[model samples]
Target: MRNAMTGLALLLALLLASGGAAGAADFPLAGTWTLTAADRITPAGVREPDYGAAPKGRLIVDATGRYSLQIFKSERTGFASGDKKRGTPQEYADAALGSSTHYGTIAIDAAAHQLVFRIEGASFKNWEGTTQRRAYDLKGDRLSYRVPTAPDGNVPVSEWRRER
Candidate 1:
């Protein structure tokens, strides 16, 4: 009985020391972050990495609760001489890497633990209708989120590492 009580006390102490009964603060995401990953997920539960060739980017969040992103992609065009240089799956994915600039805002509902990301640009937009809003989760240096697939019943979940 004493051992069990001691173990339970330790567990409670650990939980309290780590910040008790509190959700992740919305203030935790207010900073500049580099794009460490970009993935395309399928409805069949497969995750394929889509960003390569140093897909660099920045996310800036201001004090008044406003944010914007300026991201860049290195142009990768393989030599064409019947060599099939840029025609492979990896090659094609690399070739499509180009400058994709987008700007957006981040909003979170403390009650629901949901993050709403609204992003827009000149040409493309996610099927979220206007802006790309998603429910997000943050753990240490990692951030993950899920955006519901277009008109379809699928969803894409992506994980990203924080840039130091």
Candidate 2:
């Protein structure tokens, strides 16, 4: 009877291990991704780049739901002084406006086609402690999402392609 019980316990352990692997496999978005586009659609139906002509960014989402995202314009002007702390007001403004970065815990509601971000920190102070929800599309290796409308009556969209 003791030998039978031990065999049962081992079988249960193997089942649990396989179940965990299956769960991870079911989560398709847990991977590194590269930005494809960052654009905005104006109220007048004009589509324009939101992060300059050659925007650069990365999105990393882990199996445990933690994520870090960053986007930056390619044409940001460099400070003449070459010192971050000694940047002029215009340089500071340029630097601030040129990048978007945040780290947060992410939750996806696949049935709703939406994802929520519980932002822990952000380059933009206003978003540091905010919760944002975005409607998303996941097609094969590509993921796209739309941000909330901006004050300028434009809707921002970001597209990413899975890297791994």
Which candidate gets the maximum TM-score versus the true structure? Answer: 2
Residue pairs with backbone overlap in model 1? none
lDDT of 2 by residue, 1-164 (tens): 99999999998899687664657656778899999999999999898999999999999988777899999988888999989999999889889998999999988887888989999999989998899999999899999999989998999999999995
For model 1, the stretches where C-alpha displacement exceeds 4 angstroms are 1-26, 71-75, 78-99, 120-129, 150-158, 161-164
Candidate 1 residue 18 C-alpha distance from true site, Å: 30
What does candidate 1 score on TM?
A: 0.55
Residue-by-residue lDDT tens digits, candidate 1, 93-135:
5544443445656777767787776664422444223555577
RMSD of each: 12.6, 3.5
Q: For each candidate, what TM-score against the reference?
A: 0.55, 0.85
